[model samples]
Target: MSVQDSAETAVLVSEWRDLLARHAATACALDRELSERFGLCMSDFEVLERLAEAAEALRVQELAEKVHLSQSALSRLIGRLEKAGLVQRAMCEADRRGIYVTLSAAGDERYQAARPLHREVLARSLAGHRPAGG
Candidate 1:
């Protein structure tokens, strides 16, 4: 590769790393605060957040697209949520293999309660940081 190409690659990597670090920090803050305030982890909050946004139940596949976790991992997380009465899952009528996920009333309440803290954490964590291309 040309010298300029290598230099550009290094800069890109550095920028990406910075972005990842910011995400990690914000996530940690969210996890800590959410857990302390509401007995939830970051993953739990994220799933609840997504479900709250959906007008109706979401197919498991569609939810998988929205979250970062793999299918198996998301299934496990959903199982936990279901056990906690935070979410409900049902088999799709048209597709036996497909499952739909929806937030429970309790889950919606919890998400609403935590929403402010979540946004506050994000604002504080990314307070002075700028996007790579910004």
Candidate 2:
């Protein structure tokens, strides 16, 4: 490759790494705070937020996609939420093989409580990275 091409590639790779690092740092901060204040991890909070936005129960596969987690990982997360009485699983009547997940009343309450904290942290983190007047 030409020297210009190599330079461009290097810049792109550096930008990608920087993006990933920022995401990891912010996620870690949010996870720590959520765990300490709400007894919920970042994944748990993400699932709850998705459920809260849905109009009805969400299929496990659909939820897995929304949360960017593998189906098995999401299933395990749901299992933990279920044990905590924060969510419940139900069989789809029309598709007997399918399962759906819904946030319980307790889960709604928990999400409501945590929503402000989540927003605050996200806002603060994003603001720190924003260019002035941009």
Candidate 3:
């Protein structure tokens, strides 16, 4: 590659890293805020949001993928939510071995309450990063 190409690649990589750092910082701030205000962590908020968006109950494996958590970790998270009455688990009708998770009414309420906070944090974080016009 030419020197110009190398410089461009370095700049791209740096931009990517900056984007990741910004995401992490914003998520951490949101997590702390949500935990303090709603007694829910970031992961819990993510799960609740995802379930609320799904048309029907989501399988454990599928939910794990959507939330970017390992299956075992997701299972543990689901267990906590279940114990808190935020979500419920049922066996999939077609696959008796597969467990599906559905958001409970309480979970929906919690998600509704937290959604605005999530959006505000995201909007504030991204607003500073956007290009001047486009």
Q: What is the C-alpha lDDT of each candidate?
A: 0.92, 0.94, 0.94
Ranking by TM-score: 2, 3, 1
Q: 59 in model 1: Cα distance from truth in Å?
A: 0.9
| Number of the top-ranking candidate, with lDDT as the measure | 2
Question: Which candidate tops TM-score?
Answer: 2
Q: What's the lDDT for residue 84 in model 1? A: 93
Model 3 gets an lDDT of 0.94
State each model's C-alpha RMSD to the native. 2.1, 1.8, 1.8
Can you list the residue pairs that collide in candidate 3?
Answer: none
List of clashing residue pairs for candidate 2 = none
Across 1-134, the per-residue lDDT of candidate 3 in tens digits comes to 99999999999999999999998988898898899888888999999999999999999999999999999999999999999999999998888999999999999999999999988888887777978885
Residue 82 displacement in candidate 2 (angstroms): 0.8
**What is the per-residue lDDT of model 2 for residues 1-134, given as tens digits with 9 covering 90 to 100?**
99999999999999899889889988988898999999999999999999999999999999999999999999999999999999999999999989999999999999999999998888877776777886
Clashing pairs in 1: none
Can you tell me which runs of candidate 1 are displaced by over 4 Å?
A: 130-134
Pairwise TM-score winner, candidates 1 and 3: 3
Off by over 4 Å in 3: 131-134
